[model samples]
Target: MTYLGEIHSRLLDHRPIIQGETRYFVKEFEEKRGLREVRVLENLKNVIQETNEQILPKCTETMQDYLSQTLQRLQAASHLVYKLQQKEQEQRKLNNQHLLISEKQRITQWEDFMTEQHNKQAAVDEEHRKATERLKEQYAEMEKDLAKFSSF
Candidate 1:
């Protein structure tokens, strides 16, 4: 766009040089030739001016509008991507928390199972000790009965 503007400016600046050369040629020729040459130069000037002032500016404005709309769409897409990333991060955090809670529950259940097993073992040991004590008492009573029978 800037290059187009630069070329337009250069054309405007060089208009006088073209007119000077045309005038020099008209002076070298006769009156009819000078008149025809001047009219042709005027027509060419009009066309160039219309193209520079009207057509170029309209085209430039259209290009600018297109670029602006494209930039807006790109920004919208970027915003959506950012929102999705945030949602994904939030989901990951929730999943991790759920896993931590589940692990804690599992660990608690295992501890309870171990404690119950220890309690059962302690009961079995106590019963075995009591049975041993009862057997020793029976043996002493049998020895005393045998001695009394022999004396009689």
Candidate 2:
């Protein structure tokens, strides 16, 4: 193939990769779909490392390879970051709910304890009043007996 034909062929091959990046970046901007964890990005990382290794020594090759790889890496990072943020937010919400429930339970238990204490105090007070009344009756009877004996 002629030198110009070689360049044309390489450009044609790179067109798809560049377009793939463009598509994802555009999708990110549009926010048409919510982030979904389709798969682990271990493979993407491996691909980036491989692309970097190969593209660095051969600068004459298509520059589009680096552009494509860079964009893909950026998108993967963004997706992972978004996913982690969501998980953290959900955990915080659950923690708040748990704390609220525990607080309510503690309040109810305290109220119950207070009611029991009040009931016990009322019973003690009634018993003391009854005992005082009995003592007063006994003193009155003793006084009457003493007065009768003295008169005789």
Candidate 3:
């Protein structure tokens, strides 16, 4: 699936081969050095075992340190991701509030404009009624004046 996975699979598949090679090399070394001499063979075995024991603790410590560092880095990354998500949510809330405020302002402006238009219409109607009443009074006076002249 990935390069690391392939490498891990290959290592696992070759484990027996690696073990066989190690055994063969150790046997060859013993043969070349004349293992018939028991003391010499025993001494070499003891030396190899002791060296391996000494290095094992250091290797274990190094692996532990690497794992600890990796865990810390993962934790920090998780915290940062959480903070970013929180910030995004807050931003969305603020944007929604702004949109609501803008909508309310638009509605108020429309209402004010409607009220002003209604006031103007009412004023025009009142002026027309007053003009009509004045015209009626003038016509009545003119009729009375014609009647008097006709009688003379």
Candidate 4:
């Protein structure tokens, strides 16, 4: 045989071996790829679980603290409003009392003025009565003198 024919025959003999090697390598690569995918999934699951265990609680606690502080601030504001209402109420009461006192003072002054006017009227009436009595006595004396002259 020629050298080319010998080479072709040797190639035909090695074909089955090469095909078998190719199939085996493909199977190994698929298995390694599947294992790597499974490991990646497992690592992802672990990371998710860790986040749940560590970060979630911290976030929840921080949110709770913020809510608690908000509640306290609301309560403080409510208390301040209550105190302001109470102060306003007291001020109103004081104002009413002052108004009442002023009214009483005004009434007292009115009563004093009325009493002074009554006293002045009484003094004028007494003087008029005394003057009328003195005029009657003088008229009686003049009539008595006229009667004596007519008899003479």
lDDT, candidates in the order shown: 0.90, 0.83, 0.88, 0.90
- Per-candidate TM equals 0.44, 0.45, 0.42, 0.43
Identify the candidate with maximal TM-score.
Answer: 2
Between the candidate structures 1 and 2, which one is better when assessed by TM-score?
A: 2
Error of 4 at 80 (Å): 1.8
Instruction: Give candidate 3's error at residue 75 in angstroms.
Output: 1.0
lDDT of 4 by residue, 10-126 (tens): 776687788999989888877768789788989999999999999999999999999999999999999999999999999999999999999999999989988988887888777
Over the stretch 98-134, how does candidate 2's per-residue lDDT look in tens digits? 9999999999999999999899899899898888888
Model 4: residues with Cα > 4 Å off, grouped in runs: 1-56, 118-152
Clashing pairs in 4: none
Give the range where candidate 4 is weakest over 10 consecutive residues by summed lDDT. 129-138
Q: TM-score ranking from best to worst?
A: 2, 1, 4, 3
Off by over 4 Å in 3: 1-60, 121-152
Q: In model 2, what are the clashing residue pairs, if there are any?
A: none
Question: How would you encode candidate 3's per-residue C-alpha lDDT over 1-152 as one tens digit per residue?
Answer: 69989988777778778899999988887787555668777988998898789877788889999999999999999999999999999999999999999999989999999998898899888888888888888888888998888999
Model 1: per-residue Cα lDDT over 1-152, one tens digit each: 99999988787778778899998877777666877888899999999999999999999999999999999999999999999999999999999999999999999998998898899888888888888778877877877888888789
